[model samples]
Target: MQQADIHAAAQTLLSRRLNNRMTGPLKAECRPNSVSDGLAIQHRLLELMTQQGNPVGGWKCALPIAVDGLTDVPVVAPIFSDSIYTTSPCPIIADEGWCKIEPEIAFCFAQDLPHRPTPYTEQEIVAALSGAHLALEFILSRYLQPDSVSFIEHLADCLFNQGLFIGPEISLEQAFQASTIELTLTTASTPEVQHFAGKHPCAEPLLPLFWLVNFLRQQGIDIKAGQQVITSSYAGVIEIAPGDYFTLSYEDLGEISLAFTQD
Candidate 1:
């Protein structure tokens, strides 16, 4: 297929995937084999999303992942403001699209790191963040077997993110002082609870933040003031089953809960 056709088809697929949040395998033709193709598709999808009037309020990012010994660049994408909610019993799914919960940390920027010539220093990046909080990223994929999707294909799918839920804020001092968290993930319908200890993949939680600052600038995107930056998940991925009431308690940071109706 021509490059234009590839982007157009992928954009349409992404629009449907976001509009319905439907759970199923993606159409084979929309899959892109290379990261360059995926990036082209991703940006086209972003444009399509904005044309629909959903403003970009923030972004979610993760460290680079090695796929078959070749390290993929970090995953990054805009987070729609409407999709974000404070800790509450919010409805997650209805007619379609499955949700995955990932425990994570979020930083709210106080200063805008607009496209600039000079690279931002670690101190500059940290200073740009006004506060920190615990958050659960609500992930969704067009593919039913998301895990089986190729790395490039997954990157094109907005890194499998659908929405974000931000908990109460914690002081930056408190945030940087800790590196590990004791997490408890609970599903209300089954009424079962599981506990696990998880830590930041990077020794310093701010490493990804700093990397993101520079990364965005390089891409000609800026980290604006009052916008949030959600780092990678701390705990592993947990797919939200039908009728599941989800709650995540992060050690010392606080907790957030979401209630879902079965589709």
Candidate 2:
């Protein structure tokens, strides 16, 4: 199919979300032929989605988990303002009653790295960061069958992001202190108190931030002030099941709790 046809199809697919979307339609529809085309479609999808009033609040990035055993570029996508929440006593459905909780560190920018003639360096980008916070990302799949989808399909779908839950802000310096942080995940409903001696997979959390600055520049997108960017997952995807209540402690840094209910 042509690029326009592909874009329109992708938009429709994204708009419909999981409703009326079947797994069998994967091989036969809306596949972009190249990365550029796919990314273009993704931009349009974001535009269309945001036009509905859910403005872009921030972004979430994750290193692609080698689709089908083949290496793929990292995926970055806008996080809508409506879905982002400061963790509280509020209720969250987690979209379809299930959500993948990825404990991560998110950087909030204090200065805008606007579209510039010269690229923003790692040092400049670092200086612009306002603070860091402990976050739990909620994964939302655009396709009915995520595994049956292709690489570009995954890309255009924004790497299965639904939303993010960020806790109280902390100093950037304080965030760095937990470089080799120990994490404990405990749920009252289960006997499991899983402990992880976690370290940023990239050695330092800011490494991804540095990469993201350049990546956005390459894509001709500006990094806005006050916009938060979550680096990547420290503890892969942890699904929240019914009656599940979790307390994730990050060594000496801090901790956050999540309570999940079927209601």
Off by over 4 Å in 2: 1-3, 17-29, 62-72, 89-98, 261-263
Report the C-alpha lDDT of model 1 over 1-263, residue by residue, as the tens digit. 45776676566665565566445444566667677777667767767777878667778876777784457666777787767878466546532435667888888999888988789999988888889888878776666676777877777777777778888788898777657889987877676788877777875777778888888787777788988888777777767666667777887678777775432
Task: Tell me how far the alpha carbon of residue 252 in candidate 2 is from the true structure, in angstroms, after superposition.
Answer: 0.9
TM-score of each: 0.86, 0.86
Residue-by-residue lDDT tens digits, candidate 2, 61-134: 75544654546666777787776878554344454556467888889999988765677787899899889998
In model 1, what lDDT does residue 185 have?
Answer: 78
Give the Å error, residue 119, model 2: 1.3
Pick out the ten consecutive residues of candidate 2 with the lowest summed lDDT: 18-27
